[model samples]
Every structure is written in C-alpha cells, then in structure tokens.
Target: MTLNRRAFIGTGVAAAAALRAPMVWSQGRPRVVVVGGGAGGATVARYLAKDSQGQIDVTLVEPTRHYYTCFFSNLYIGGFRDIASIGHSYGKLAAEYGINVVHDWAVGVDRDAKTVTLAGGAVLPYDRLVLSPGIDFVDGSVPGWDVTVQNKMPHAYKAGSQSELLKAQIEAMPQGGRFAMVAPPNPYRCPPGPYERISMVAHLLTQVNPTAKILLVDPKDKYSKQALFEEGWAKHYPGMVERIGPDFGGDKVEVRADAMEVVIDGTVEKVDVCNVIPGQKAGRICEMAGITDGNWAPVTGYTMQSRIDGTIYVLGDATAQGDMPKSGYSANSQAKVAAMAIRGELLGSSVFPAKFSNTCWSLIAPEDGVKVGAAYEPTDEKIASVSSFVSQTGEDAALRKQTYEESLGWYAGITSDMFG
Candidate 1:
C-alpha cells in the first residue's frame, strides 16, 4: 500500500504502541545508526539525540573528524573566509548531545541483519539506518580525470584539502595564465556551486593576476543565476570570464591532467590550471545498501524513508527527492523531517505533516550576492515547491550586500544547528 502522511502516522501509532515498550526496555533504547556527518547526517543525528531525550541511542558514522562544508567553500577560495571557518568538529555532537560519533568509514550495510560494517573491523546494529552519505563522483564522467590525478586537475568539489589545493594553484598562476573548469551537468550536488566557484576564482585572479583568464567548459546550456553572474563578471571582472556552452562543443570535451591541457571539440587548449567538477552519484554506501534506483536513492518525501526498504532512510544530495536542489540547506531541511518521522514511529510521538524549505545564495563579487529559494510540501509523488523567489538581475547594491550578510548569518546558524 502507498504510505501517505495519514496512513504512515496511523500505522506508526499502532506499531509504536505495541513495540515501543518492549523495544525500549528489553533492547535498551531503540538504536539509530546514522551514516555520514555532513549537513544532512549531522543535522539528523543532532536532532534525534536532542529531541529524543535519551530515549533513543544515536550513533553517527563519519570518516572525517572535521567536516568541511561544500556550501561556502567557494568563499574560502575567494579569500572571503578561511578554510578553518568552513570546517566543523563532531565533538559537540558527542559531548553536548550525547551522540556516539564514530570516526570510521562505513564499508557495508546488511539490511537483513540490521548491521553496518565499518572499515576498522567493527559492526554496529541499528533499529533504523539513516544513509546520508552525500555525493561521490561518477566514474569517467570526465574523460581523463579521476581521483588518482586529482592532485593535478583538482575538482575541489568536496571542500577542505581540494579547496586549499585549488586556491594555491590559482595564487601560483603566472601573469596572464589561463584557468579552466569542466563544469558538471544537471542533477549534481549544488546547482549554483560551479558558477559560484567561477565567480570566486575570477575574484581571486583579478586581485592577484589581473591579466589571467577563466574558461568555463560547461555541458549545460545555462546555469543557476546565469544573468546575475554574467552581469557581475562584466561589471567587476570584464573580459576575464568566458563560458562555453553545448552549442559551442563545451559538452564535447576531455582533459589531459598530465599536460594541463583541455581538449574541446578536437581543439586542444593549454591551461595553467584545471578544475574538473565531474558528474556525481549518491555515495557508494547507498548502493551497497541496495537502496538506489539509479544514481540516487529514492525516498518517500513524507518521511525520507527509502522506497525499497522502510527501515532505511536517505537524505541530502544522495536522495532522489524532487523539487529541492541538492544543496546543504536542502539537506538540512530534509534531515529535520526525517528526524520527526522517525521519532513518531519509534516513540509513539505525534506526527506532523512534512514541510521543507531551501535558499541558495551566490556571491558574485565582494558583498554582491544573489539568492533563490522556495517553500516545499510533500505530495504523494514528491516534495513539491509551493512558492519561490529569486534575486532580480538589477537589484540595488545595498540589497545585494544585505543578501550577502544574510548568507553569513545562515552559515553560522546552520553550522550551529548541525554540530550542536
């Protein structure tokens, strides 16, 4: 039967009543294992621990102790913020919220056994498994780029080390040198991310090497905030940024990381640095769990539960939820909904209708920001956008600065929400 909000809540209430007491007392509180530690996983872990009041045993699995946010990594590259600013520690989740934060790679998930195998030779048993492992690059999406040659091409899409490497490369570029970016196609993590990185790269190059040029080799015909970015590029860094679309064979391309050259439509162009943002799919762990439909894990938006297995939930960039973009803000929003639904099912708590919202902010230049956002509600089919807004092309400077300031506030608020 199709599980809509009412049916889900009704069944949950009945099952929770019968199973809650035995599960809690006999099993020593229902165990919840959350894999991943970024915006979605971290937020869900924190919320489950915070709201459950010790009735749930929450454990978070992540490989990195210091989680680097992909959302604002561009600003770090542009020198608006430092790398440390974008990095967050899982200490608060352990210390403050009483979550068992395991710093280990989750290698496998056994759904039948309800156990997760870690790389360090430990297994975790869970009553509910939340897989929010985020995105992993699709193999050979970019013809000549992979993790082995990442040091040379440097996707820098994951933030932290890659961001530092890309920034260092931009700084070390000789005068009038060329920088190339092979942008990913649609349905990748962070729709506006590549464009924002382009703007930030231009910002940095304009300051250090004014004569340097940027080539955006994009497979998409258009990108998020195209007009705003185009206008800003012309006004702030004129004749510096150039974009090649599919019409011009931008989609037909390959890179030579060894030679630092890009081959576009049989035309080889030498570049000083190449940033290859490749096509992406849900994190590998999702596939290992046998929960993915194609590249993404399909979930019921009403509760973020995997369509294949009701015991498993997926969130963030790894999910195939409709309408919402694969962004940090979107992930954070989805996490809350999942947390609420899980609590209702496990603890017999009240279940409320699911709602979600997201806002994507892009900085074109210093204090020049544009935004797009929407409110969403879960339908039988998907999470549908109910209302939306976007910054106009010719917005005033004061307004743009206000938008930028707003983004800073959101970053602080979200990081606190996720970590604490």
Candidate 2:
C-alpha cells in the first residue's frame, strides 16, 4: 500500500483541533515524550511530528545517535554489506520532522504526575507518553551469563557494539577454528534470526577457512522456517554447520569463558569464538513505570496502551502482544496503530479499528533471501491471525534473488518511513 503523506497530516490536524477548541487552545503545544528511538519509538515520533504540524511537541529520549538494525547485521559479518549501509541517523527526525532528540537515559517515571525523570535528575512532564525501549537480557536465564562476561561472549542481539565484537572475532579466528553459537529460547526478537546468522557466518567461514566448523546449540528442536533453513544450510554449507537440538543433546550445553571451554553433555570442548543470544525481557523503564508483569508490559491490543496506565502506551519487543512476534516490522505497524488511537482519545474523535501487518526477511546467502509475514486483526482481547505468508520452498533461483532484492527495498523503505 502506498503511504499517504497528505492524508496522514490531515488526520493529525483534525485530531489536534478536536482535542482543544481554538478559543481554548493554549500557547504551548501538547507534549509527547517518547522513550527509545528504535523501530517503534522512531516511527511514532516521526509520524506525530510530521502530522501534528507544531500542534504537538515530541521529545524523543534515546542514548544512541544512530540505530543499527539487527535484521541485516549478519551481512556485515559476511563482508557483503558495510555497517554504514545498515545504520541510520536521527538528524532527519530532529531537523526535518521537528522532533526534539534528547540523548539521555530515562531513569524513572511518575505515572500519577505524568512526569519522566532522566538520569541527570531532570523531570519532564508529558501529556502523552510512548515507550518502545526494546528488550533487555533476562538475568540468570542462562547460567554463568551476564554483562560482566559479555566481552568474552557477545550476544550481538542489539546490533551495535556486540555485532562489531562478533565480526572481529570471526575475522581473527585461524583456519579450522571452531565457531559456536548458543540460540535463545522461542518468542525472541526475529524468530528466524539465529538460524540466518548461522547461515551467514557459515558462508563466511567456507570461503575464508573451509576447514572451519560451526556448532549450533539450540534449546528447542523446532524453529521458525526450520525446514527451509535446514535445506539451505545443507545445500550451501554441507557439514560445515552442525545443529544440536534439545532432544539431540543440545539441552546440556554450558559455557565458561574465563576457562575458555564449553561443556556439552559429558564432553568439554574448546572454541575459537562464541556468540550467545540470550533470552530477553522488557526494558528497565517499563518496570520503573509499574507497567511490566514479569518480563513484559501488558497492553490493550486495540490501542497499544498499557493495561496498568491509561496515558502510557508500550510497543516493540518490550511489550507482550500475545501472538505477535517482537519484530521490527511488527513494532512499526503497532506504533502507527497506537499513534492513531492516541490521536482519537486526545481529540475526542471516534477511534479507528486497528489492523496490523508484518513482513520479516532473513538472508540465507548473499543473493538469496527467505521471508515470513502475517496480517493480524484484534480478536477478543489479543491479536488474532488474519493471514500469513512465506516464501515458496525449493523455488526457482530467480525467485530467491528477487526476494533478496525485495528485502533491500524493504529496508530502505522502512527506514525512510521511520526517520525521514
């Protein structure tokens, strides 16, 4: 579907006017404070800034100056794409969209007072708040795993420093060195990410060090697009990639980076490099705001508003949206819905019924890509499946190439939609 810039701006103006009559309109614009400038938060901030036309003041709080997506990060490791190609700047959001980009961490939240406190002891009041802080690692989920040992074994899940660390390790490994990966549990960001990472890294090893081997330690026996990934690995990497599932001795894996050894079952193995993707939970801000239950923030599916707080809405990987996977595409789609919902509520207009769509692409090789997508609608209290799509299995060679091209186009388009 084509993006309607004019219609979007028109909707925003009408919503703002409806919220406050011209006679009662104050000199100051309504304040909207957003935390996390990732996929979800960036989209919301851009749309609101573009549409509101100075009627709304948007303040985005994020510590990063640039965002590097995890989707195509494996390409960087494979030396097929440069890191700059996948990185985006917040300059457009600030200069063009009129968003105030604050480079600071959100330390606390006062829900009753509608104020957010930063690490520097400054409190910013907001008429509305949007949070998409992404995911944080779950402590003790994997024994002997924490931030202290992260340098020895990087997660690379957040797609910046860790990603660079992993790439450097791969390049420094000697010929015939072993590369091991520990996959996270199900329902993590990007369901097919771990397998795709293995594919790209294996591809790199085959060219640079053909004798090198890869060990995949997975907690689950099944995974998203398992059959397709396995087919590609077998066809391209052959025995170079060995996958061990839970039923097949994968559950007994243990790591000791200080000792430079990993134990699988009864055997202690040494590896030249290791990449561990850990299980995740909601960011700390969600917990501080009292919106999280366990590791996720519960939200109303229709509005993406927190179940515990009316003025606050949570989206992205940090929120529990039932069946929707915590993916960038999903987060972007959900942010638009939440933006519309907030507009409706503040403006006293009829809320539009929410419909969401997501398309996630995984690269199996430099020129080959596989994608899985779904269209969703709110059913009862949570999101329900409307339709789903996946790339054809054993398809023509040209189709795979086309999918790769499409993935690149999507990346460009989505980035533009978010920051441009």
Candidate 3:
C-alpha cells in the first residue's frame, strides 16, 4: 500500500483516542479481527494478543484446522520434507497465545460497520481488521483449465491435497516419460515458486526416472534467480529439462483435460504428467471487500492499512506493496509493522519507526540453494528496496549448502513466529 510518503503512520495524538467508536464491543477491551490465518494473519493476531497481554481482544478467522504452508511444499514434493512437517495447527495460537481462533471462512467484510460476517453464522466486530487471504488464480490464464479440472492438471499452488495429487502423478510417470509444467506469469505469489517447484520435480525425476523429460512452458522471458536455477539444472539434471519462453510459444499454450493433451505453438503433445499454474491475483476475499484494485489490495505501507478504508489492513500475497515479493518472510515482516501500528492506535502503545526486510531462499538440488533478498523502506509511492543480495551463478558448494541450511532454519523460525 502506497501513502503520500512511505513512513510510519500513527493515528496521531488527537486521532488515537477518538479511533475507538462503534467498532469496539461492549465487553471492554479493543478487538482486532484477523482474516485468513496464513503467514500474515496468524503473525499479526499472535503478536497483537501476545504483546498486548490481556488488553487487546484478538480473533483469527480461518477455515482450516491445519494450515499447509506453500513455502516448504516444494521440499515435500522433492522428498526432502514430509507433509506433516509443513502442516501446522491453530491449537497453539488458541491455548498458548490466548487468541480466539475460529475455524470458519470470513464470508464478507462490512468496512463501514467494522464487522466480519462468517460463514458459520456469527458477526464479529473489530476495532481493526487484517486481511491476508493469499492468492487466487486468474480464470482463462490457461485455456481449458480451471478449478473444475484441477485434478487432471494439478496446480498444487495452495499446498494441500493438490500437492499430494501432483506428487502422486509424478510417481506414476513411466520411465523416460514426459512431464509438462504450465508456469504462471509475473507478480504471482512467490516470484520463485514455479521455478522452485520445477527444481523439485527435476530432483524427484532424477532419482525415480532419470531419463524422464521436463517441459517448462513459461510466459516470461526470464524469472527470479534464473541464472542459478538454469546452471543447477544443467549441472545436476543435464538435458532432462527444456524451457519454452514466450518468444518460443510459451504464452501460446493450452491444455485439454478430456484428451489428456497439451498444445504448445499449436503442436499437440500427450504428456504423462501436467502441472498447470495459471496467472494469479489476490484471494477472493479482497475483491469481495471492495478494497482491491482488480488484483491486489492497495494499502498504506506505513501501517499496512487499506488505502480505501484506513481501519482495515492487508498483508502478504493479497497486498500490492512495493519492492517486496509475495513471500512468507515479507508477509511476516509486514505483520509486525501493522501489529505495532494497530496497538499504537488502540492501546496507546509505543510506536517505533516502521522498517521492513525480506529474504527469499530457494533450493535447486540437494544441499544446493539460491536466494534473492532486500531491505526496504517506505517511499511516497510504495515500499522500495534499499540494499539487496543474491546468490551468484557459480557459487561454491559450501556456500550453497549454507544457503540451503539457512532456508531450513528460516522455515522453522517463521512458522514458529506465526503459530506461537
């Protein structure tokens, strides 16, 4: 979210006391309602309730009993991690953090009324609202492909049973079989997600079916950490993977679920496995709240508050913030900022200068990883990058291994930050 200046936005001395109105319940404490318990929502809710002690009434509205993170899901697909390792429960947030974790979909957001309508038939009032619903695919981004036929050509973007389905399809592939991936375009969740998934698939195929071929149908001419990934693919996987860019009919592609075929450049090919990741936008909840600019929620980077409605904040993949990619780390970082601002407004808490940082690490092969990250600050326009670093194309093995270990540590740290 862009503001007049990328700076910490306080409700100010005058507005802070007056901020509490019909938004607060008669119970006593100021209430904060968080939607979509992923990286952003979970972290915000936990921090608000934990730091505020018993002052702030925090409620997290989530639909799943267990959340399967999309961050380490590639490791699950590559056999480096198990599904249970990436899955987390909200029990800790409820019992330990004292957050009222409600397992139900937030069906509608009444910004004017400052209430969230849940599918389970409850109206939740909030002094502030945080929405971090993640991403939803764009219809017709890949022709003949939608949620209806998600089984035949699995996207596995949401990281649940879809991930299991894709892995099963990969294991079922015959030796020397063809595997096709329909990659998404730019500005999608996790800029490096599709490529990391390809790396994982290649890792699995090398072990199970070394002779198998991977077809990457990519709309972009290049992608995040392209050099590092391509080098690793050539060194480790050899000629097993081939890429089709937009210049070479990557964009002109379609899938046929009924025929089990893929058409690239008008050439029909029958593949044993298909992983179709279509173009993505913000999750449906943002659009339903009428706070989205077509694809993402515009917010004030200073506080992560919605530009359309200051009382509401947006985070993670659903927000169109500056510089940072749609990463779990970025969302977690933004959540802390929003949590501080919301507390400052509600509880007269100390407000520090807002600053944000993010790092996205990706694994290419066993003990081989690459990363791209930056420190960011608010500009009058958006959150802009300050200093950044990335893995070199031909890094030493020890450094790569260190990077891989760093990613594992980050996974543990961030999940703990969100859940605990």
Highest TM-score against the true fold, candidate: 1
The lowest-lDDT stretch of 10 consecutive residues in candidate 2 is: 8-17
Ranking 1 against 2 by lDDT, winner: 1
Candidate 3 per-residue lDDT over residues 3-97, each given as its tens digit? 11112222111222222332344778888999989999998998888777768999999999999999999999999998999999999999998
lDDT string, candidate 1, 145-198, tens digits: 899999999999898899999999999999999999999988899899999999
Instruction: Report lDDT per candidate.
Output: 0.90, 0.82, 0.87
Give the per-residue Cα lDDT of candidate 2 at 254: 75
Better of 1 and 3 by lDDT: 1
Worst 10 residues of 1 by lDDT: 10-19
Which residue pairs overlap in candidate 3's backbone? 1-299, 6-379
Q: Any idea how many clashes model 2 has?
A: 0
Candidate 2 lDDT at 388 equals 95
Measured with C-alpha atoms, the lDDT of residue 276 in candidate 2 is 82
Could you give candidate 2's per-residue lDDT for residues 188-216 as a string of tens digits? 88888899899889888887888999989
**Could you give me the TM-score of model 1 versus the true structure?**
0.95
